[model samples]
Target: MTNISRSNYDPEVEESEYDRLERRWTEQLSELRVTQAGTQIMMGFLLTLSFQPSFETISLFERNLYLSLVITATLATVLAIAPVSFHRILFGHPGAKARVVSITQVLLRLTLILVALVLSGTVALIFNMVLGTTAGIIGGICAVVTITTIWIALPMTVLRKLR
Candidate 1:
């Protein structure tokens, strides 16, 4: 997002569309690999929380919130890693590059949305257990709004301006 990073924007680089797609796919896949690792770790931790000794004392609302967070986190992990499976299943087949890259792009976008939700839910669940429901709602709303603005809206605004 800075000028130092923007120095690589070689608008003059000549390449076929297929080649561009291949490059983009590689770059996107690498980015998603980092995301997938983090999401998997979160999912694993969430899955095991119910077994903790102190977990049995939680209120029903807190227990339900934790379950919902685990489910949402699981979905985020699935969405984050789905494109990898998609690529392997179709790799190098005729016309697969374009199709894989296009689908992966959409999946990546959806994965980010899921990640934002997972983060918001985590914040809400934790705050609800620790501070109370009102604080939980406020924390969740703040997290979702901040992530949406920074991750989605800011990029969109910049893209619109460039167009």
Candidate 2:
């Protein structure tokens, strides 16, 4: 184990599990607010492309890619917001906080993956439309690399070092 401890947490301070769960829930909710905003913006941008005149000129592959992006992005949005819905439904029930947090964490991870795909798809679609199929493939690869490095590997490395 990394033996990591919270910078602001005081070991001397006694707290109940409920209290801990409440604090964690609050923190995750705040984080969700940030993620949800980004998802909304991406989805909004993706939605506008369907109406573009150039949209009709895309190849079957590009059209499928766009459609997949729309689906993935929408699913990401829903998954990101699922915790709140789960919270509302389970609020005040016994062990509600723990249940909500656990469920949300899994959903959040899935949401990240879908969001990553949506981002890569968006890049590929635009680059293909503007530059060429080869350029679009390059763009998609770049987006995937960027997201994986910054979102997963960087954090995992920092965590490993802390451990």
Candidate 3:
């Protein structure tokens, strides 16, 4: 009937702080690699849109949306790569690995938000161009909802359950 305390310590998989940090950094790098590739590709596509012959024919609103998407995508790409730059600049400094990991986690979250916006905007733009304004708005809203549910809500729910 006595209280028992539970600890996360697992002797079978012992890891030093430095080793844990290294593993986290490695995993973060892998995630960033994937995100960077997608963001760059999206940026490239957005950049090429203006050169198309039909680009000049779009409404002002569409043009503004496209510009915003381009800017957001660029920001996302920069954030996705910021972790690597931070690590490079802080390399070999004491406690730098932990700092890099913390910064990387923040950057990654921001990048994901920007990526979601870019994706939703892209869908809106395409729908607006092909269908109508109402369709475009609906598509964008649906995209946002779906992304939020999958990316943010799902993780939060799992974390809450774990806690």
Q: Write down the TM-score of every candidate.
A: 0.87, 0.90, 0.89
**Model 2, span 1-163: residue lDDT tens:** 1355677455335668778777778878887898798789899999998998978888999889888888889999999999989999998898788999889889888988888999998998889988999999999999999999999999999989867
Q: How accurate is candidate 2 locally (lDDT)?
A: 0.88
The TM-score-based order of candidates, best leading, equals: 2, 3, 1
How would you encode candidate 1's per-residue C-alpha lDDT over 59-137 as one tens digit per residue?
9988888888788888878888888898899987999888888888888778777788888888887887779999999
State which candidate has the highest TM-score.
2
Model 3 stretches with alpha carbons more than 4 Å out? 1-13
lDDT per model vs. reference = 0.84, 0.88, 0.92
Per-residue lDDT of model 3, residues 15-101, tens digit only: 788888888898899999999998999999999999999999999999999999999999999999899899999999999999999
TM-score for predicted model 3 compared with the true structure: 0.89
